[model samples]
Target: MERYKDIDSDSGVLGYEINNDNITVWFHGSARPYTYSYASAGSIHVEEMKKLAHLGNGLNAYINNNVKFKYVRS
Candidate 1:
């Protein structure tokens, strides 16, 4: 996602998700519950994009190179 100038970096991670029929986005702090649906996912890394496409649903997850996210809509 494009950086939000007003977003507080230490407050959370800002992310987006794009599916065939919808695009969603949200953010969460390190110790807070994940929030979703405010924007769209684009220009993400190829492998991450592929992983997200395969999952095919929405999810609240951490972004980790080793820990894969689940339920992402293709």
Candidate 2:
């Protein structure tokens, strides 16, 4: 996994990793990570997530507002 870029968020999303088909997110105080995919969130949402992850902003809000329950916890 790649290193997670730190971001400012009140949602406890510490960082994220974007892959070809999935995204793994690290929460501030959680031991487990959460993963989301195009299947669950759709292609458009996945693309937007990738953009937000690269920009190092709005990922938390995007997930919260868009795909909060669409992830698989690991």
Candidate 3:
């Protein structure tokens, strides 16, 4: 069983379930779903998931990184 911290730390994802053939990642407060198939122990599929997680984190970082507020003088 996986810990909730692992899932909570991952943005847009609520949790994950590992099965024999694949892993299902729960997202959007468990409203959306994504499935991923597993390959060999050391395979591209695993790497792909890692990349996706990184990309997701990067996107969140980019969105939250900077902001500007402006007001026009009357």
What TM-scores do the predictions have?
0.22, 0.79, 0.39
Per-residue lDDT of candidate 1, residues 1-74 (tens digit): 43323232342334554544333444555333222221222334333533443453222233344223322333
Q: What C-alpha lDDT, on a 0 to 100 scale, does residue 4 get in candidate 2? A: 46
lDDT of 1 at 52: 47
Name the better of 1 and 3 by TM-score.
Answer: 3
lDDT of each: 0.36, 0.78, 0.40
Over 1-74, each residue of candidate 3 has an lDDT whose tens digit, in order, gives 23223333646554455565544555555545445554332234534444544444432232233211111112
lDDT of 2 by residue, 1-74 (tens): 54445466445577778889888888778888888888877778888988887877788889889998998644
| Candidate 1 Cα misplacement greater than 4 A, ranges | 1-13, 30-74
Model 3 TM-score on a 0 to 1 scale: 0.39
What's the TM for model 2?
0.79
Q: Model 1, 22: alpha-carbon shift in Å?
A: 0.9
lDDT of 3 at 16: 50
